[model samples]
Target chain A: MSGGKPLSRFHQPIEVPGRRLLHHIHLNFVKKKVVGGGGRSMNQEIPLIPFIDFLLCIVLFLLASFSASGELPIDKNVKLPNAMNAIEMMEAPIVAVTATQILVDGIPAGSTRAIIDSNTKQKIEELSEILKNKRELWKQLKPNEPFPGNVILQVDRKVPALVVKSVFQTAAFAGYPAVSFMVGRLAKE
Target chain B: MAGIDTGGGHGGKRSSNHEIPLIPFIDFLLCLVMFLLVTAVWSHMARIEADAKVPGPPREDEQDKIEPEKELHVHAKERKFQLVWKEGSTVVEESEVERVSVNVGDDVTFPELAKKIGKQWTDHGSHRAAADKKFDRAILHTDNNTEFGVVIAVLDAVYTPQREFLVGNKTEEVPAFHVTFAAK
Candidate 1:
């Protein structure tokens, strides 16, 4: 001990090879003892049980919400129409028609303004081409099952029906007969 | 008891007093939370499924020749919807359907239009309204300049009115009519 204070076991005094050394011992084996006002143990135990429980619950909920199809990519520009009687969303190649452009499978296919302005009863050339390619890819992936011809239309609520009609016709021309219009789900009364 | 030893008071300290490795557990949970938050789909997405008819050569056989079992055509315009019932090929003038057009004015929005359309279905369109109600299938033909919102609003209105029907063995509440979407 130095000046009535215990030294840590590691800081032992050195001695000659032939000489023996004597060290002071204290009842308190620890390096230091805190003289806290409260009669409490030296160790501070963090309240971790509640925190762990919360994290586990969060993990469980997120796992439950996770779906096999993964997350559906939503375009911020498209304000989807709300529907009360809509069914659960199906898996299909999404054809999103935004304010300015039309996208097939997240890739820009054509200009929305041009399609609306033309007002032609014909299928959209660009959209149809991309959809056809998607169809071919689908056919290759699932050779055994007949192609469902399912396609999802994610169109802005304000988009005129003319553009939607053109997209519909284009999807049909590209062998997509089953069209699913994606919409926000409204709570039932 | 089966956990990491914190090395507390090591003089004759027993391993049985070890505590759970909460720090490491917390780290693992944090990683999982981040992964799930990134991957989770928060919004509920719903689908309105319909068949898009492709223009093809007129059927040589009976599919086209035969009178459509139920011919209910809806002409969707910019501000009005003309709900028509057809017999054979002619658009019915007024034997069964009382009103054809439900117009949306400056004050009347699509929601109000939906309510009006739903009123029509619940009042006269469904077989529940009348035992001899004409159509069970309706065709929606949307025109240019009409907003897609209006089209979906009309669909929601049609789908709103439901009746419990015996299907196979179970009786379930289903939409009054099956709607097919078409563009003209």
Candidate 2:
């Protein structure tokens, strides 16, 4: 404020007679030599601490926000129920049950009405066939090892137990006996 | 890391040959930061594994195996949890069924249930003497009319320990029972 001129007020465009507006800017900014009289280039050295701090903050924020585990492709139609003691989910074959239909790996295996209306024995034969094929493929992939009968069930929170049970029975009959229910984590009070 | 390359090295040495552009460097960092920020979502999905074994015909060898002091059963109704178990019969066929009911939202009921089941395993004279520390597996049956949330709540109650104990430098909570669901 002491060395510089006061800011000019703009009412309308007025031509100045003797003084120029942009003449002082080049003199203030452009310089031929970086070294000062004391042989220390104070203006040339950029303080990198602030920049480092900013970079560190961004890195930490990205790290904290990043989910290390691979996420299961979430089906927008199926809203999972919340559970208190739920554990981290792993990659597996998924069986999603929406309000209207049943899906195997995102493919429509059968209708929810068909499973709920029909008797337990007639519950979705198509789902069992798909599951059996998946099990066979998994077995072939790992010949010496025993098959881990893990199946992930992503059912809508509003879906009834009847539909869930039908899916389970079909999966079990198809050789995937272990069923894991996918749920949202309920916060502790 | 972005830096302003000054042609002047240290100690006031002057050179005009070196000048690094910072605009493109900052542009790349901003792009990376924006990409990461946009993709970041706090996912809360977790899993609870259950063995949905289909009940088959009775095997001939099962008749000889004597039942432990008690066998656990959890009957999940629409709005209540009915826990039934047998006390004194050597074989499951002769055991008496003792039933207890707790409403869905009772906070202490699940802890109390865990305590009851844990005591049943510990108080039994023979079960304590066995080499394996694990208790007998329990069967969970949810009625067709019940919602899946209630069943999950029951599973959480069964799996999570009632109390956490500070042992040495770490805290530990022992599981009460290994549970399986009744087939559809």
Candidate 3:
């Protein structure tokens, strides 16, 4: 006991500022200290809360955006005709031709087939004139821009191909060049 | 010297480290959310809808009001082409013809049939004149089993440039020959 140094330095009690009181408690309770004579600090651990919050925000944003855009309702029973180059419908007029009816923007327009016989040539001419007038009116509505005007032809699988072609020709004659045939994507095999 | 030791000890013992500010990251994520929402809405706004139905002719009693020249019935059977004048219920003409080998069981080839009809129109103009002035329409009756492709082929043939005279003798060239699908 006589050879040992005085206990004053080893048992010294240090005073810290009041604002650092909680910090001191956390340091004592949470961090492990090395007890070797040579005392040095080690690198502290990084917090994970902010990183987690960031990822959550990203996920939530994606979910919110996807939910807002509604999917186009296509009839599963009808199989649409395929083409090598089919463009997506963007700002195009929708013309739905079901097995029993023809609808333009959900409104019933006319019968699927309109033919001109020698006797009804006058009627056919009248219809053609009306279509031409409508095309002119559309052009007037959106002047100075290349008519992004398109026709969406939704035909049933059972409808005759001739009927479909006739409709296509009629629309083409009416001055709409871009036509899109809508079809459902088949289930993966 | 005593104060210095105490200060060093406290500084070394501090557990909570300096952290990167998260406000910037939150702002970035919010911007991304807005961008995605705007894009989704734009796609929805760009969509369009259309319908595809073929029309058929009216019935006999219903046909009384319609002009006779407006209806022409074309009966396509195994190997015969029968042209019926609708208003008079009179068989204007019948022509026996060789059937195309193409899967045209009851479906007539429009091109071949149209050519034959064109020849008949020229040859029997007198008979057609005597039948009805409104004999402008041709009602095509096909078998249920006939392929739509064959019918289209027939229509293409009938409405071909060469067969345009079937519709009218007008100086202006008409691109389509008038014919309607007759209900069975």
Candidate 4:
């Protein structure tokens, strides 16, 4: 500890008479003169306090955001519709209807084109099978509690209403009646 | 130089005084900030509630029951939207209906459809009052080729409160409609 007075309680970089030693470590490309006080630096203090405050503000904003659920898995091909009146994301079985495919809980159940083309006036068999199993499992888990017939439908913007109707009917036919459309939230309410 | 200068003549070796590693702490904070920023965007996913009443097989005890509230439906077509008013869920036949023709390409026309919807609801408000019901519920009937963006736009428009009414000394904003995305 063979030193004079501490240059700063928050340490300041030590510099020479004409140049800063820390900065000169990189090869000086241009020969330029620097005006430096004896052993003191004329360099402005980096505004770290304000920078930290800004970061804190951003952190606070993100923390206080309406996403108690950290992140939802958004389908790659599906473009969600933007709505101002949508509520917070609800926890339920997601039936994602893309351009070509119909997915129940991220698992491919069937093709959208097939459902639209086939003239069968029936609920989607594959989707119904999976949902029925899920319903039974939920019932087994909580026998006393009644089934909360809620399912979320996340459909792509381009997909026609025909496919959406089919998916909706299939979900309801499987005993999940209370449906919620999963939409992307717009800027303001 | 990277580590903290602890046991030295820089300050007296007071047990309470310890040097905190600011560089590593700053590194951790940078990591946290990056993580929070990345995760924040996915939270934009929200939901619109709609009741899809697909009547199941009836039990022996329940037989004849008619729902009193009318299910007003807005049918979306390629170039026009048809508003169908029904007296009850049991009432299969459409009573009074109106149409608003709009080009599918023009997004502005969709909001106009919502305005028509609001006006229709206001006109029926008196009839609803006679029945002692606040019939703000509406159903959206969309067929094949109707864009989901257009559906959401119409639904959002309907969800917004259009009128503020003075009730007992306070101005209360009455919401336009609780929209149900009807699929049959």
Candidate 5:
């Protein structure tokens, strides 16, 4: 085996006294030499091109998917009343007011039955109790602040104007004065 | 050849040549995107719009100020109510409309008033009031002393379904033909 001198530049078998019985001892020696020399050759280095390609693909996929899944600009079921002087609020938190209930951040804030009952003008004490509870909750969330958040009220079109007014009054009594009504932009078509 | 021979024997022990596969990172971002897509909610806001006007007559140059739509003015005074229906420059109807009066200390529920109003409007042929030129609009104005509940009850009575009547003797129930708030 020693007389057969190494012919190829790619791989050469090695003979070590202690590891002669090892099945891949010769190939292991050649692999070590090829990988160790200067340590910067293309064959010896890790292939980062596929990894970079994979990363770029992942980045593009995430960007596309994130944009597609972002919060929706508008909902169609809410038929907002029109106002000649209403301005758009792009970043405000949403509060919905259907014909029968008030929803704060999609959770029911108060019942329409309660509001109507209070509007009967016989339940001022009950109305005051509800207002006080709302105030306490708001204070806990935002200590020393006058309001809970930028409230966007979405009242249904079919609700009476008086009912809407009473809701606003109740909200104001609850210490939320910076409330704004929500409205949709007219569709182009 | 001697350097290559010496280097080949020692290269296998280097840990710097190892690299981590990237399949796991791709999996993470995919999971994140899925989570965001599933949790997002999309809804819109609502607002109101109306016009306000003061009573006045238009001059010759302001002839176009006359809006074609009729305006009905109803005011609830002490123990009585007034209804003024206007169409253009002419007053189509003006009269003192009567309401059921309760004693000084009686608890009158809205449902009772609603029934009374419903019966009166039905008997007075309010269903056909829209077809007649005698009235354009019916305005209901109430005093501050008037209980808001009474107003809502009156409105509810006028708008709510009272009873169901069957058609063609089939015994199928349908809402009674009643007064609609749309008329006012």
Candidate 6:
């Protein structure tokens, strides 16, 4: 108790060492509080649930909202026709008919007039040959299954009905009975 | 607490609560968002089924069964439509002709023709006419000079009549007929 006596005016000279010792004790208490209790109790980990939520949102958007139809190349030359009531086109062989030329999946088969003139009676010869070749290739891949005779016909909005009808006939003659006209959605009237 | 504790027990000690390195993680998230946004396709392409009217040899029994078949011919002229009703391979007189011109707000308007035809079909109690009925199939005849958009508009009008039913909060469209195309 005498060693622990309070410092007074008379003890001021001896109190310098005591003050330094007291400073160390305060720092130790602070260090313990910082490292042991309140600081550790305050968890610093980034809340993983929000990051997980963001990841799940992105995954759901990618999986659920993605279009079922794969990308179909749009020809710059052919302005696709518009329709009020239309459904999404399925993936199939494409027959693109512009004003001047006809393309089978981006490859020029023949001139529009040539195909029409070659078979004035309905069956377009060149297009039918191209489609027939395609059908054969498809059949080779799936020998056990029947060929799904479907074609995606993309025609320019300015093209005449005659050319479109001829293409339709050619598709039918080529063993592809179903022709789906690829069209853009018409704006609301 | 006083004299001896300072030099005996305390020295330079470092803290252990190091901050998490988050810059790379944030960068990863930003890149992923950009990649998904850039590759996303928003617009949808649609299809309208087109079938060729192939002329084939008619069987004797098939001809006998179809001798009484009725047909409706829709001739799409410039700015007008001529509706001709056919009965059993015979073209009848008294055809109903209607005109479809561009409205004030639209570039091409042909739904009026569809509305008129729908009215006629409904008046005749043939709105739900079967596929075997002549009204169920419409032959759309158009010229080469006519715009394909106009033809499609007319086709839309014929195939999908404006009559709709409300199901819950959504309105449902009632489709009418299958259309065949003829070029002049």
Each prediction's DockQ against the real complex: 0.47, 0.46, 0.07, 0.46, 0.07, 0.32
Local accuracy by lDDT, each model: 0.71, 0.66, 0.47, 0.68, 0.45, 0.66
| Most accurate candidate by DockQ | 1
Which CAPRI tier for candidate 4?
Answer: acceptable
Model 1 lDDT, residue A188, Cα: 66
Best by TM-score: 6
Candidate 2 CA-lDDT value: 0.66
Model 1 docking grade: acceptable
Question: Residue by residue across B46-155, what tens digits does model 2's lDDT show?
Answer: 99777764654578777666545565677665444555664544433222223343443422224454444555545432333223454455678777655666667677
Which ranges in model 2 have alpha carbons more than 4 Å from their true place? A1-46, A49-71, A119-123, B1-17, B54-70, B77-80, B86-135, B162-174
Tens digits of per-residue lDDT, candidate 4, A71-149, equal 6777898888777667777778888889889888899987888866773334788998988899999999999998998
Give the per-residue lDDT of model 1 (tens digit) for B1-184. 2366555756685545556667887999999999999888766899877676555546567374455453567666554566766655776532222223433331112454455555656544536533333336678877677778877776776676676666566666767777777654
Tell me which residue pairs clash in candidate 5: A33-B8, A182-B45, A182-B46, B74-B141
- The RMSD of every model to the true structure, in order and in angstroms, is 8.8, 8.6, 17.3, 10.0, 18.5, 10.0
lDDT of 1 by residue, A1-189 (tens): 334333554655753344122223243333233433245558776777888889999999999998766668778889888877888887789999997999876799999988767767667788988999888988899999889889999999889878887788789878988888998876665
**What lDDT is reached at residue B129 by model 6?**
26
Off by over 4 Å in 6: A1-46, A64-70, A113-123, A143-146, A187-189, B1-30, B55-68, B91-94, B103-107, B123-135, B162-174
In CAPRI terms, where does candidate 3 land? incorrect
Give TM-scores of the second chain, every candidate.
0.55, 0.54, 0.44, 0.53, 0.33, 0.60
Reference-based lDDT, residue B28, model 3: 69
Candidate 3 segments exceeding 4 Å error: A1-78, A81-90, A112-137, A146-149, A184-189, B1-184
Per-residue lDDT tens digits for candidate 5, residues A8-85, read 655756532342223344676565555554445444445655755666675566565564535533334444543222
- Each prediction's TM-score against the native? 0.68, 0.66, 0.35, 0.65, 0.36, 0.68
DockQ winner between 2 and 6, please give it: 2
